[model samples]
Target: MSLRKRLIACLDMTDGRVVKGTRFADLVDAGDPVGLCLRYAADGADEIVILDIGATVDARPALLALISRAAAVLDIPLAVGGGVRSYDDAAAFLDAGADKVSINSAALADPALVSRIAQRLGSQSVVVAVDAAAHEGSWRVRSVAGTLETGRDAVAWASEAVERGAGEILLTSIDRDGTRSGYDLQLTRAVADAVRVPVIASGGAGSAADVIAVLREGGASAALLASLLHFGMVRLPELKARLAESGVEVRRPLPAPRPEEVAAWRG
Candidate 1:
């Protein structure tokens, strides 16, 4: 059987509110993280990614309480990232019901952290996030919530992270973020080629066709969406229908409700 294309909805949380922005700046409130997760679960999202964008900088807790609430309400898998610096923080997220913990700045600062987490939580439980920007004609990794440039080649870092036992890479194109055009296919394909594990392409997803383009051209195993879903620009059922029609392997959609049957039931 062909591998199914995975669709993930990212909830960028700060101070318990879901926020989104372009290039990691000018964030606007989306909604409550818990409520959004529940809604996405109902919408047939494959998985939910909760990113605590403020935790690391503020030295605050990683929002385990919020994650716990979301987990309790969602049946789909949850992956928590941001401000996850130590083993304890990662463990806390898992304890609070996260299926996976994603590390980026922490891992880049100390690459061995990924190995340590992988050893304890298993490889599949660890995902390394790489926020990359095309700079000086090369893809360079960014850290500290995309505010600080790392001056490191993204593909090289991704390869090293995987070798250190990261089971997945959440590759986000900083340039393409909030653009609603499409993914940076070249950058995504380069990182995907460098890593052995699954690469989730993030940023610049505007529509279902954009999702298809990323999977096909970027060689990504999955795509992460934010603005499109949060703004109601794309409906999950219709997106899945388009993917199916285009011959991409995706989760089968739930059957549509019959209008007459629904009317009789409501009556």
Candidate 2:
């Protein structure tokens, strides 16, 4: 983990609209995908991630227009995921204007794809997403949007993915997703310690303290937030201020957002 922490806003999309769910169920529309992303970037998000949550299950690729439109205006990096099954798939995503392509189900099924994309596009452009769920007593890797268990240990799989050329790990805890309690510190620290690449901890960010806990005690390089930021419960600038106040090294948060901007959209 780096001394300087990163704050990322993730827009989980399905059917062109940004959506969020409790533990990936009973999804509700968050906002317009492109519009929300623009707001997050302008509000001081370090990176904006647009994930096509339904692509894999639908046997389709991520929406290109959404990525292109959002990427066109943002200066910050944009990473996208879902339905990336091959090198060509990833390359097409980059062509659509994404800074990085994240692969979850595909990576687990064919680990070689990670190396293939890394070999041609460079590891820094590849993000391997690991979604894990707590089993009887340990964490197991889940695939297809955390719906199916692959019987693989989360920590070990993360290590293999990194060795195979993944530049970073986007780790999401299925149990904690949308709970708004906090990130799974034990799961995060275990994977962070096992892998050499930076781990972007995802799920259950309800407050600034939760963010601080993951970056510090959880040993994550970055915190990936969705519901909290999407719903306006925690503004990015204020969150960064709280982080800095707690002694976590972070970029000075941008000034408070205008009233009109906040009224325009929560995401």
Candidate 3:
């Protein structure tokens, strides 16, 4: 059986509002988290990721309420990240219905936390979110909402994350984020090559072709989209169709809307 390309929609939350931006600057509100996630789920997204953009710095609740609302409405898997600094925080998200907790700054600060969370929950439930930027001819890991540079190579960190029990790695290129150009293929491949677990590529996905490139050339198992999907620039079904035509494995498309169903909605 051919490996299927996973489609993941990312929800960047700030002040309880869904926001989208390029390169993590000038973020504009997209919509309410719950409503947006529900729409994506209905549109056939395989999984959803919620990142509390302000949680880590503000020390506020990591939008558990939003997560609960999303989990109640969407049937697919939900991964919550940002400001999850402790085991309690991770547990809170899980209890609120998140299938996985993505740790970034916290995990980098204390690598042992990954193992602890995996032990308490399970290896499959822990994801290490690595925000990396191309610097000085190398991809260095960044933390604290991409503000601080850790001086560590992206590939090495990804390897360590897996050893510490991270089942998945959500690798984002801060430089390519919001560019709508394409992914940083070298960075994606480096992390994917260093890690044994699944790698979800983020940043620089402007078109369906970008998604295809990430999976095939970057060695990413999945691709996470934000601006493209949030702004309706790329519809899920259309993108899936393109992927299918390109010989990429994707989930079957939903049946076409029946005449009566469309009319009823219109009425």
Candidate 4:
């Protein structure tokens, strides 16, 4: 297996538009989802995770049209989620050009959905998303656009998801999301250690060093980026080069940085 850690771009969507919010609220427009996905794919992002952050609250379905459009342009894998409530919902996403279907609230409501999707579509095609926030000295799982706290221990839920056939865990720290403070290494490491499957650390990532810290010290197999990439804080190639320089294995063919960009990254 490749030891190269993955760098994933996360596009949170609401009403078909890419947007991001601080701690899952006060969302503002970022860009078009399809355009961003295509750009990330071309820029050497290992994968793209498109989440309809409002779907569950709006009582809408997953963004099938957006997924189809993104899949058409993306040569890399696409993982789509949000408002995936049943096995049929998960299957529809896969049929709509999603390489994998991510289940969040639905999985929490009915753990059987994870196993059913894996049994039908294969575990490799299932990604379980855990949006957790620190609560009372421990992390609690939140769902329904992060408005509801299930009181489930984050690490225990991660292990249970894996046992239910989730091939990977997308662990997002609700406390750090969109803050650019840094990833919650304590939360990430706890979940990563609890699960044998790959854990994609999401949420805070203000600098390249934050990502490297998660991969090297937090024990994550991948890092999910949002505000950093969405707001032009750091280019994917520049970030990958920085990681490689720090002894992190990453996919090659990273573009040579322009002198100006290099200076910008350093500055």
Candidate 5:
């Protein structure tokens, strides 16, 4: 039997507020990052990922204060990323509250940065995030919050990142991001197959069925959700129930009260 697939919630932040956008553009307010982090954890999200989307572009550090606040409320593992350019940057996130720190563009700019951070904090504490966009039938890595194309193959970068001491991969599809279509199964399968570490499939999650599809057909060890969960389209328990029925091993959450039950209880 395989390990139980994880359900992770992604909170994309801009200026300390949760935001969502289509194809990484057209930003819209979602909710409070800290509040959502706690809600997701209580609702049974296996892990929580908070990415400061603007940190890199603004030439600032990862939102350590925001990360610390979320981490304080999160019962599950908290992964923080964005503007992690050096060992000290990664260390600060860990010292503040993050369980794992994710490095993206900075890792691409200096591949050694991944190893440096891993050497100090342990590989398990480092997650290499790859944002890829479909280009000429192949996926190329994107950087600076999906604005710059690095011309690096997503699968190749993933394998190399793992070799350099990254314990896991947070692979996000730039094209599919915020689209709610579904995950890029081929892209996820390619990276997951090429890498020894766990791959968390992100972008394009629309429904509970989409989560099941990604975990089963995409060969992903986990799925990261944003729009659907943020918009109240699907809850964690509903997703886990769907995955269980599809014969996918999942960390089943406690039963949630039905709408009518809640209404009656409230009265």
Candidate 6:
């Protein structure tokens, strides 16, 4: 049997506040990152990924103190990114509270960094985030919060990153991000098939069916939920229930409330 598909909650933070926007622009505040992280964990998210979306653009380190605080409260796995540029940075994230550290432009600039981080922290601790957008008829990788295209094929880069010791691929669709249309299934399938490691598909998750399509038809190992979660469009447990009904294996679902409990709660 294959590993169960994971449902991950994504929190994109900027200047200490969680934000969401279409195509990574026109941002609006969502909520407190750490508070939201705790909520998702309690609501049965398989994992929680908190990214400092502005850290790289601002040329500053991740808010380690905030990450540590989030990590301290969570029982599930935590993956963090943004402004992580070196092995030292990666190690620092792990030391602070992240179970895994995500690297974007840094890994693209120096693929060797993946190997070094893996060599020390193990491949399981390394997550290579590939932000891709539609170009012509194929997908190309983007950097710096989807502001610049690298001209590298997203599928090819995912493969290379895995070869360099990236244990997992955090593939996000820049075009579909916050659009709520659906995931870019083609790009997701291409990278998922090209990379041997588990691929977590991000961006464009509007409904449970969208998640089902990405995880099933798209061959993604995990489905990343952002706006759907942050904006209260879909609660994590309810979404997981829908996925379970759709026959996509998830970590677990919230136990059903007893009849008596339900009755008492209804009072």
Clashes of each: 0, 0, 2, 0, 0, 0
CA-RMSD of model 5:
7.0
Q: Lowest summed lDDT over 10 consecutive residues: which window, candidate 6?
A: 21-30
Query: Can you list the residue pairs that collide in candidate 6?
Result: none
- Model 2 residue 161 CA deviation (Å) reads 0.1
Worst 10 residues of 1 by lDDT: 21-30
Candidate 3, pairs of clashing residues: 22-178, 23-177
Question: What lDDT tens digits, residue by residue, belong to model 1 across residues 134-193?
Answer: 987779999988889999999999999999999999999999998988999999999888
| Candidate 5 lDDT, 34-129, residue by residue in tens | 767777788899999888877854434437777778877777899988788899988989998999999998999999999999998999999999
Q: Which lDDT value does model 5 have at 65?
A: 74
Q: How do all models score by TM-score?
A: 0.88, 0.87, 0.88, 0.87, 0.87, 0.87
lDDT of 5: 0.86
Candidate 6: regions farther than 4 A off: 20-30, 56-62, 254-267
Candidate 2 global TM-score: 0.87
- Candidate 1 vs. true structure, TM-score: 0.88
Residue 155, candidate 4: alpha-carbon lDDT = 90
Local distance difference test values of all predictions, in order: 0.86, 0.87, 0.87, 0.87, 0.86, 0.86
Tens-digit lDDT track of model 6 for 1-267: 457899998888888777762332223423567777777787888899988887854434437888888889998899998888888898888988899999999888888999999999999999999999999999999987888878898888899999989999999999998789999999999998898999999999888889999999999999988878766778778887888888888877657679998888753
User: Model 3: what TM-score?
Assistant: 0.88
TM-score of 4: 0.87
lDDT of 6: 0.86
- Comparing candidate 1 with candidate 6, which one achieves the higher TM-score? 1
Q: lDDT (0-100) at residue 199 of candidate 6?
A: 94
